[model samples]
Target: MGCATGIVKYLVFIANLLFALAGLALVIIGILIKFNVSDATRVLPSDFGLAPILCIIIGAIVFITAFLGCCGAVRESTCMLTTYAIILLTIFIVQVAIGVYAFLQIKDQNSFYSALKTNMEKTFDQMDRNPEANETMHVIERVLKCCGVTGPEDYQTPKVPLSCCRNIEVQCPSPNNDVNSDGCAIKLQGEIEKNSKIIGGVAIGIAVIEVLGAIVALCLASSIRNSYRRHTYA
Candidate 1:
């Protein structure tokens, strides 16, 4: 029994240590993504912009929970272990719910694409009148290596925006041969799809880890309780 409890204790400690690292990783990833996608966030749905903030919040919670679990394991406290188990389970459920919500939101590719196109068109049309819009469009185009919503033809004038040029430093030729041929909508959609897969993969991985940690915590708590009862009765 002592051997088994010792193994479980060490396991819990290791698991919580991993949890701490994962939490820190999440915070860093969230901050990086927030900055990296700042420009694209302007054109995306408002809810989409909240993703990084959510990550940071979740990460902080996980880090705190991990600390609790580590303390409980090292001290062999049944109460703390049980509390840690409950928190882990709660976090697991919430993560699953959020994942489902995100999946459903993006399931309808057609609607998402249509909405993106509409937003891009609106932003493009307002470029001349809205300085912010103009700057945003230019940044999007330059970074994404894309042209107007559909193509250079979307522009009323024969010459495309300087941002559409493959090389911003050089002058944009009249023939527009040096411009990117891809549409911003298509490029943006592709980027979202690619990033969504990565996010989904990470979420699934974290969920698995949470479930395992919760199970281990509950088991350890039960063992501690049983040992205490045995000692008391003996």
Candidate 2:
């Protein structure tokens, strides 16, 4: 019993310690997103503007709450552990709610993609005029192997960029040739959905950890109390 109790205590401590670090990483990521996104909000459409702000909020909450959880585990305090459990549960619920709301609100993918396509076409045009200025867009086009947001036709002059061609040395796709007809919007949407799923999975895993931490804390607290009671009676 003594060894088992000790093992539980250490396990909780190590788990919470790791969680504290994860929380800090999240906070840093959130801050970076806020700074980076703030600069691009002017150019980007309004629909995705709030994502960065939400990241910042969620990150800050995770950092603070995770710190508390770490402290509760280290000190073996029942009250603090309980408080940490409640806070984590609340955050988990909020995360799930936000995801569901976003999914429900953005029902029509095509319209959103259309607006994004317009934006991409403008960026491509800018890149054509001055490659250095729109270097990022050029890189994305090349990396994604996509010509435009919707299709190559989205190019104003009915010409495909060299980035969209399978072999730059051979020939670039033109208005008449539909070699690289894949739309970047679809690829971008797929990447976003994939990343969201990853984030959701990680969140669910951490929530499970949080539940275990709370249960262990409560059980350890009870064990400690019982030990004390036995000593007092003896």
Candidate 3:
């Protein structure tokens, strides 16, 4: 009986660990979603465009894992808990890989945005002369202006990188930000921060709670298995 309880405890431990890991992952993703790309020198990445959606989905999964882990840990079931723990570990590793890849992607996006901005600046005048270039430049400049930079400023300072456009206070996606203030700049910085910070930070937290839950499960499983072995041998 004592051994059995120990085994069960091991299983519970594994589950708890997995769940904690999952929860951590969720918060990380939530953080990422809130982060702003303009200041980060990164535009919305093409490949990572779906990252926010994926984080939300993963966060839900982590929350569910927490619940399951809590249940298994309380029940002290070795085999079941062990299975959960193993699964959580696997997911955790995968999440780490995804995080690394995402960071790399952000770097790549930053570089790309810089290059694109430079090229755009160089060709802005030509755009007016060429119909296609005109349309493209008009659209691109509009986005830049909306994002907070003065298009004319770029002409004065050609040495500045793409990020120079970021300082201009314009209408961001945040609800509270009023684009029509004095210079079409954003207001309510707190609101802006909350919404922007969710992107990169949240993306890093996938499967965190699940890892914690797995740890809890491991404890429960160990306890249960030990107990079973002791009784069966006796």
Candidate 4:
């Protein structure tokens, strides 16, 4: 069983190393995409339905896996190590699935635009009804002013919606629509949202998994590399 255990450990080690690489790559890409989004550059379609919060969460997971892999390396317990590798890989698979879902969700651009128009009409209707709601319309106009866009599907126009204006320092418009524009901004908003979500998100997710896998593999390659170092180095 020592030979079998060693083999398992080696396999687990290889897996972990791959995952580590993948995770680190993912972390970098995720950070980049996140930064771009912060600049108010819409990269993903709004209809993708994945929130920016979700992107951060995934990036955070890739980073967390880094610590987990390191812990396994120091522990020298193949069982504990393999557990981490599996999780890293699992998340990569899940991320791929999310990408597919996002693609399908936004594929029908016309439908998405229709939804945006309907929502805009609904919001303006409420705004028109109440005297106090007048400010909401101007708020929306401001978003149009900033984004330099007009109308729901008006991506070519030169006016950003006023509603997109916000006090938040990060990501001008929250992934959540409650804070931003009424129609013009919100309607075209989702277009860049999904790409932003998947580009770094999927990239990092895959990279993290691959790196951890490689790391684990390397750990097994040098099975006895640290047998003595474990005690003396400690």
Candidate 5:
């Protein structure tokens, strides 16, 4: 029994250490995505824009929960182990929910694309009169390295925005060779789809890990409680 308990204790500790590292990786990924998408978020749907923040929050929770599990394992505290298990179970449920949401969003990519295209078109049309729209479009075009909603042709003017140029150093709105012929709508949709897939995959994977962690925590807690009971009776 002692040897079994010792093995379980070390297993719990090692599992939690891995969990902590995973949590930190998640936080870093979230931050990178947040910064990478900051310019595009201006036109993105509210739910899509919130994904990075959700990732950050979940990562923080996972880190704290893993820390608790590590301490509990080292101290052989049944109370802490039980608490950790409950928290892990809760996180697991939340991660599954997020994963499902992300996949559903991916499944409805056509509708998502349509909505985004419409939004961008509206923004482009209003750019002449709306200062905010103009600024947003400029940032989107420059960062995305694309032209108008559909392409430079979408601009009725003979000279498109300088941002449409593949090389701003050269004379823009000139030959096709100097311009970015791709459409912003397509580029933006591709980015969103890629992000959704990533979020779904990562969330599902972590949820599986969380379930295993919860099971291990519960088993460890049970073992510790039984050990205590045996010592008292002896």
Candidate 6:
């Protein structure tokens, strides 16, 4: 039983080390994406963007907590293992709550579509007022292959934006016949939902793994305590 417990401790340590590495990678990727988004939205309010930052923060927390678990498992320390288990359990609960909230929020397509359209119109207004915002919109349109909120007709211009041209070289001379009729809002919404589902699924999966880690930590801690008690009595 003692040998088995020792092997479990090593397994926990290895598993946590891998998790720590994964978390670190996630944090780095999140930070990079956050910087890109921040730069693109430089004219927008700091408070207006938070998703990437939140992702970075969460990844950092996961890394820190998993590293702690790894250290606890290596040292076979009761206090450290207890702390590790508690933190993992808390994180798992928070992840589950966030997943549920995201699921609920995304379930209503009509409300989301309406809200997104309104937001896009507001963004269009902002782009008109700010040159930097206009540049950002062009970048978005080119990347997303979308013209305006609903379609190119939404823009009150004689010609569609060059970024909206299907043939890249042939900037549409007129919106009436040249521009693609697809709305950016629908494409943007689809992408947002798809990414959200992927993230939520990953979080839920990690949370389940965290729960298992916590249970293993607690069991190993108990086993170590019993071993200590037996050696003391002998």
Candidate RMSDs in Å, in order, are 2.7, 3.6, 10.2, 10.9, 3.3, 2.6
Question: What is the C-alpha local distance difference test score of each model?
Answer: 0.86, 0.68, 0.51, 0.52, 0.82, 0.79
Estimate candidate 6's alpha-carbon lDDT, on a 0 to 1 scale. Answer: 0.79
Q: Give the TM-score of candidate 5.
A: 0.79
Model 1 is weakest, by summed lDDT over 10 consecutive residues, at 37-46
User: Any runs in candidate 6 off by more than 4 Å, and if so which?
Assistant: 39-48, 176-178
Rank all candidate structures by their TM-score, best first, as comma-separated numbers: 6, 1, 5, 2, 3, 4
In angstroms, how far off is 187's CA in candidate 3?
16
Per-residue lDDT of candidate 4, residues 71-135 (tens digit): 66556655545655566567767877876775665566666556555544444555547643345
Residue-level lDDT of model 2, residues 134-197, one tens digit each, is 6655466677777676777776665566777766566564764534677776776666556767
Model 4 — which ten-residue stretch has the worst lDDT? 39-48
Off by over 4 Å in 1: 28-39, 129-132
- lDDT at position 234, candidate 3: 88
lDDT of 6 by residue, 7-107 (tens): 99999999999988988987998888886666564422233366677778888998998899888988888888999999999988887887786677667
Candidate 3, lDDT over the whole model? 0.51
Error of 5 at 163 (Å): 2.7
Which of the numbered candidates is closest to the native, going by highest TM-score? 6
Indicate which candidate wins on lDDT.
1
In candidate 2, where is summed lDDT lowest over 10 consecutive residues? 36-45
Q: Model 1 clash pairs?
A: none
Per-residue alpha-carbon lDDT of model 3 for 22-61, expressed as tens digits? 6678767755764733222222224434656666676676
TM-score of 6: 0.88
